[model samples]
Target chain A: MKPKYTSLQLFALTALRVSIGWHFFYEGFTKLLNPNWSSAGYLNDSQGWFAGLFHAIAGNQSLLAAADFLNVWGLIAVGVGLLIGIFSRYAALGGMLLLAFYYLSHPPLMNASYSLPSEGSYLWINKNIIELFALWLVFLFNTSSIIGIDRLLKRK
Target chain B: MSNDAENSKLLGRRNLLKALATVPLLGTLTYAGLKKHSNTAANNVEVLNALGFPKNTGLSIKPGAVGTIIHNNNPHIRLGFIGVGGRGRHLMQCAGFAPPEYVQDWMDKHAENPDDNRYQNFLEQDDLNVSVIAVCDVFDEHARLALEAASNADKKGQKDFKGITVKRYKTYQELIADKDIDAVVIATPDHWHAPIAIAAANAGKHVYVEKPMTNNVAETYELKDAVIKSGIAFQVGHQGRQTESYIRAKEVLDKGVLGKISLIEVTTNRNSPNGAWVYDLHPLATPDTIDWKQFLGNAPEIPFSPERFFRWRCWWDYASGLSGDLLTHEFDAINQVMNLGIPHSCVASGGVYFYKDGREVPDVFQAVFEYPNRDLTFLYSASLASERHRGKVFMGHDGSMDMDGVTSVYVDRASIKYKDLLDRNLVNPDEPALTFSSATGNIDAITSPTAKYFAKRGLLYTYRDGKRYDAAHLHIREWLDAIRNKQQPSCDIQQGFEEAMIAHMATISYREGVKTYWDAEKEMIVKGNSVKM
Candidate 1:
């Protein structure tokens, strides 16, 4: 069964998806082009329950390299899929996973201070948490079928 | 038929329009992204260039290679140790000979935190193509520890392994005379440094001796002459030569950023018994276990009081006290950067105001060395009772540089060189004008808060891939490289000669309460010119 949406709902949902896609795509592309780019600093700067896990990855050069490779390619892949609405479900899932890692690594809980500078003040509902929920919304209430390349994908 | 064809065409056209709708946006974004990154890169380069730094000094962590030399490329060199005390054992560990206890320690640290890769790095340390062939020490326990360290293969800290046949030489001369030994590392006391190194040099063996090269004025020239006459690769263990920041600091000084530098202040502060050279006298330390005669060397005969043997730095007969032990550190580091050879004159005064536990050397000391040629005064101050941080600072007419922990440059509010930058508001006097950071390996003007945060975490240190190299290891590697390549090591005989003379001058000024002069033509310390003690 196909989902139904008003013109306004469709525009809002697709715009949110495309905006997040642009953010992730550019983030990945920038890192990809940078020869000195590594996730070591951000990973080493992790400060939550999963800080140790991230630190472990950062400490090991080969593990850090793998993480860096995955991040650069994953962001680009998720961005492209969400932008064009091709494989939108998988893209949304990948975005959620990345966001979950980010959120876990630097959860904005009480008494937890991050070394790396973040955009705005965050208690619990930070940008990553907000984006995680938004990506979930994009997963469940996908407007890509009506307003994107998913429209063509529906026939198959 | 016409209605069906029109409907199908409309459906196909709508599908094409939806599918290709965002592809043009993607192309536009790609173009925009390229422009943005290119512009940012260009701007960063310009800003960095204006600050007089290379562009690649951004978060650049150099790998923990042997000092700066690749060791495996060179052939194997046999090593012999003359002193296996704390410093010597550490030097051996740096040369990839980790004792069982040290290996266990590093492993335990790693187990506690995966980030601590000391054990792993020790194990994975590049094979420096060197073998510890013989060990020598006056104390039995230290000798045994050295033997254990030398025999431990692969630096894995594993027990019950078939190890090398490390011969334990009771005296350093025997160790130096070993034909199998290609070179000797003289980690002995200040008194033994000259004798052992002189013997080794005469034997055509390369030498790496510990700091303040020798104890007295006589041996200072003697060691230099021997090293020159031997023509062997000699290195003084001022491991500060391998320090990354010091290297960068030298580069910055060479650039003349600190215009007309006048005063250089360096210091040492500690608030502990051990810090005051009251090192623990081991339980097993006894006349039977220790060769008191060998330990005393040529000092006036005294009963074997374990105090003197264990805490040798307290006596003027053995160690040169704070002047030789600590002052040489600051002097050599400054000398490495400033090229201020031997000072023109030195004035010093201090007393054992703190730990007055029958120690002959002063607990609080200050030495001011005047370099008339360079037009600068180098001041070194120390206190064993106070736990204060007075870093190495260079005050200049245009700016001041603090290269104690991190290489930071601050422009003078009233300045000649930085006038244009200050007027243009490109550099703020309130903050660092430029910093060669130890944490990020950056030369950017990192904010004070950011620098402090990392420093508090103990992350702001010289990097051998973020974790600083065991500088002693690099120093040893450099010595070997010099031996193999026939090149001069960083802290060579000439540097050692100046270091010894400088330290001796300070010691003499303190001892005689006189303003000691270094007569350039006569090449000897003239101490009778000032008020006597």
Candidate 2:
């Protein structure tokens, strides 16, 4: 027997998917506009556990050169996949992976200093935290319906 | 009394057992839950407070008037001016200095002794309203001189300075103890800056200390934490910091007008001897009136040398040299513009080439710092010498900016082209077909077959603009208003602390000849030779 979810549960799951998908898709599109994009800039400028990774990439001229091409394509692919809900689970996972790389590369929390409690403390809510939370929701809900290619592909 | 009687009537062995066992258990659970809630609430308050927001006040729409002056809803602060020396005096002479009627006349009668010329021009300005209520200095002569100036101005119908009484404080300790004084404007020597600020905060007084908040790294954090806990205002005197031009430039940069910035180069240079820390030695300072011991404060105990006491910027004990003074201001301006705090790590190298005044800090210095977002290469070369590359240049991948009184942003258009359009495809080859028209003998080859496929090539666009800013007075006005309204200022104590923290890291890098990194989560620099110190 197939498992059945309540109407409320189904609605919640669908809402979670759409919100996270839209967020990921928008972020990817914006990053795609710029010509000059690379991990090396973030790498050389970061000082954390991943400093060595940044330093290694910074020294690799050939790899740094290829990063521009990869970044543009990566963002576009991630955006389309999320927005259309094509390969829905994979898209969600990919968005998280890309954000994780960017987060580790620069780690916004490590360098930010707040004037008030709201500005600096790495509490439950922040940009990185929000994005990570959205990614987690995608995993939790496992939703791929409503204006999605996944449902259509399943029917076929 | 009724509740107690009822409790006694209902008392039984089972009831007692239940009360004793279950009630205590429930009480413990309630206490634990309440504590958890309290911790969460405290953290929430802390976060809201740091973000310039309060739970009860509701969310405010932060106005983005970058190059425009927006009149803030703040009250007129009753400013009490302490020092009337160089920078202090200049600020007072401005049109915005005068206070109201009651205090203006009292300042007039007290300054009748000396017919001083310095206060003459200041009195003539009708709008100058910085009410000089109290002016204090260690040297009784300078104190007397400043008092006399305020008195002369007051007598000459400069009614705003009317009730200004010049009190002679032999030490900053006396000024700190004064119950009437709400805040202090510290224009003291570099060594005394931190101590006086700390003392003022402890005495429940706000401090607007002259730039480079401290001479060392450790003191900066301590002072920052102290001010935060005390719930008082602190405005670090890097006057140009909150200017419109800088603020606008920052907005544009953050908006990615420069396109994923990776490199920032900042420079502070000077041509003249005065700019190079070559000030003529004053003959008046002596051990009797100057209070050399008080000047030293928390610095290592050393003999009273007149040079160290007067031109304190030259000595390491009293100053961080040009880095702390000049470069710090630039660094702060740059940081404020970018909204970046301390860099992840910094490496500095430089030495003193000229002006062997036995000063410990080098006349020249350069440091490369790695911020979380990007890398900042800072260079400070001061000579009793040449002025080349004298201004600050902030170079980002999208564009570059230069800072004077105004900050100018310039973009290189070609830096933003779409990627796939620029790449050549060698996967498939097509041969050109030559054909002759029946009517004409002209042969045309199929031109641009590649145009049939792929998207249009988009050009990378460059944009540039410049603006001049006057925000020192505005910043002060904003702070005063916040105090009156119980609102937070733009750059509060915590923001000031972040700016000061970067200077400490730079100092660490320069002093230890090693890279310095800060662990933001830990609120400490990761252990290194520089951080260890």
Candidate 3:
């Protein structure tokens, strides 16, 4: 079957995926090098319906430690997989899940209170959810097969 | 749909299956890694437990015999006084042991104003079941005055005090050795605090020592060991522990109202000379009346100077200056509310820029204590030269707490995370938010304009049934009740040790001109490279 998308469209989608991958990779890398860094503070500040769940995770040392490990390593793994276009679909799914967790924790609901400053105002759809859907589009298009390592692997 | 598009979708599903197949393997690897990390975390917890980390004590207020008259069911506790100076006299007044003359003078002064809180508080002291049996001081003036206050119980119109014989001793050792004295209140110079306290503990007498607990780290451990070994009820005079605002702050903190506090700023400011510890020297303090040699004890031998005797807090030889004298109060109050113990490291920098009266300690000081484990930092700043007050503030992720007489919790306005709760009215908005204030109208000590402002907002004292109570009196009553019940007081030996160690870290950092770390396991200050002081 012939590919449907034009080269420019494929290029744009690949660029979005790689850029988002780099963002995730840098965040994970910085946290990895910093011994004192933890997500506990962010979790503790969680608001709205899932606040209790987030607070519980923050309160339990074991759970917090586990979250720290998974969040950091998962970001790095998903970033690498997406950037190189190897296992791109799985990475997209994983990235969507991570972003979903962040979005649910804070939930860009209207009029909710939070200590941290927001990048932009939103009722339900914020940057996290926006990027989450973008990742979904990247997965659906299978942009990796067009211009990523997946293409070479498939050819081999 | 076209046959080519359907065929392409089928191809995409095939590719997705291949990508999904690798995820289970990645999941397996992640699970193994987490298992190894959990074991390491368990070991870390064990180590923390060994170092007395993760304090579990909760705030539980046990009301003592304050504001109530006690029937003489048991024999009164006989208390001996050591260094009957300013603080000692105040404690005596709190214990209802002030001489009849002193009470009469106080009452007479407040006679025109029948609603004076100080006068009322002083009157309430008459019901305390304690008697000053012996008084000791290096200064004859202080000892003689204390003796007069203790012995003269026959003043007209004051029928609560019955005339009791009081003995005056020249030395604390002699006073502590007295078989009739069951307890001792040591309010001597900072250098003499631990020595008298340790001796009194060894002599089987309970002790109430003033703050900073010890002159140095070595004495801190020595005092702790002595009190623990003797099993006496030792109370460090951090009277702010009884402050109602702090007690309520603890309650709010326990509720996680201001979630995950990471930074706290504490401060002290005073504009007056007396506030800077430039206390008045007694006119009668002559070499003949004062046992200058006995007062020197372990301090550097010097000629009889009334300045050193009266303003001991100005010099390092006898006192810890701002860190011990003032910072301890701030630290102890925060510790009571937060249960924050010793910091991992501290860096202090300040100088005696204002008062240049040959003082060994600085008049302006600032210290930063870092607790990496808890991801928190405490900053302390004090200036005796300025009257501008900077109240304590605790910064958390959800909100920040500004603690004064009236503590306030402010939520974050720019928070996206709490948008849902705010919209649903589950939490109050940033403006016109929740606030807590004392029920009592006002109390004494709100003399300053700033204090009056706080008082107007009900910030100062804790109130019960529309009446305010003195924190010092409550603290003293707690100590006495602990003495009667054989239980540890609020600021016990362990608390005193931590308070002294942290306060000393600030002092050492400022004096030595270096950063200091608390070696929690060994319980000692680890000094860094020295800089110019």
lDDT of 1 at A34: 69
**Model 3 misplacement above 4 A:** A1-156, B1-75, B115-117, B152-164, B420-432, B440-460, B464-467, B529-533
Q: In candidate 1 chain A, where is summed lDDT lowest over 10 consecutive residues?
A: A33-42
Per-model DockQ: 0.41, 0.01, 0.02
Model 1 interface Cα RMSD in Å:
3.5
Interface RMSD of each: 3.5, 28.2, 14.5
User: Can you give the lDDT of residue A29 in candidate 3?
Assistant: 62
**Model 1 TM-score (B-chain only):** 0.87
Please give the range of 10 consecutive residues that has the lowest summed lDDT in model 3 chain B: B440-449
Top of the candidates by lDDT? 1
lDDT of 2 at B332: 78
Report the C-alpha lDDT of model 1 over A1-156, residue by residue, as the tens digit.
568888898888889988888888988998887665667767878887988899889877699889999999999999988887878888999999999999999899898888766768989879998998999999999877776788787878
In what order do the candidates fall by DockQ, top score first? 1, 3, 2
Kindly report, for each predicted structure in the order presented, the TM-score of its chain A compared with the true chain A.
0.96, 0.71, 0.93
* lDDT (Cα, tens digit) per residue for candidate 3, span B193-287: 99999999998899999988999988898999999999998899998876666666676688676678889999988878998999998889899
Q: Please tell me the interface RMSD, in Å, for model 3.
A: 14.5
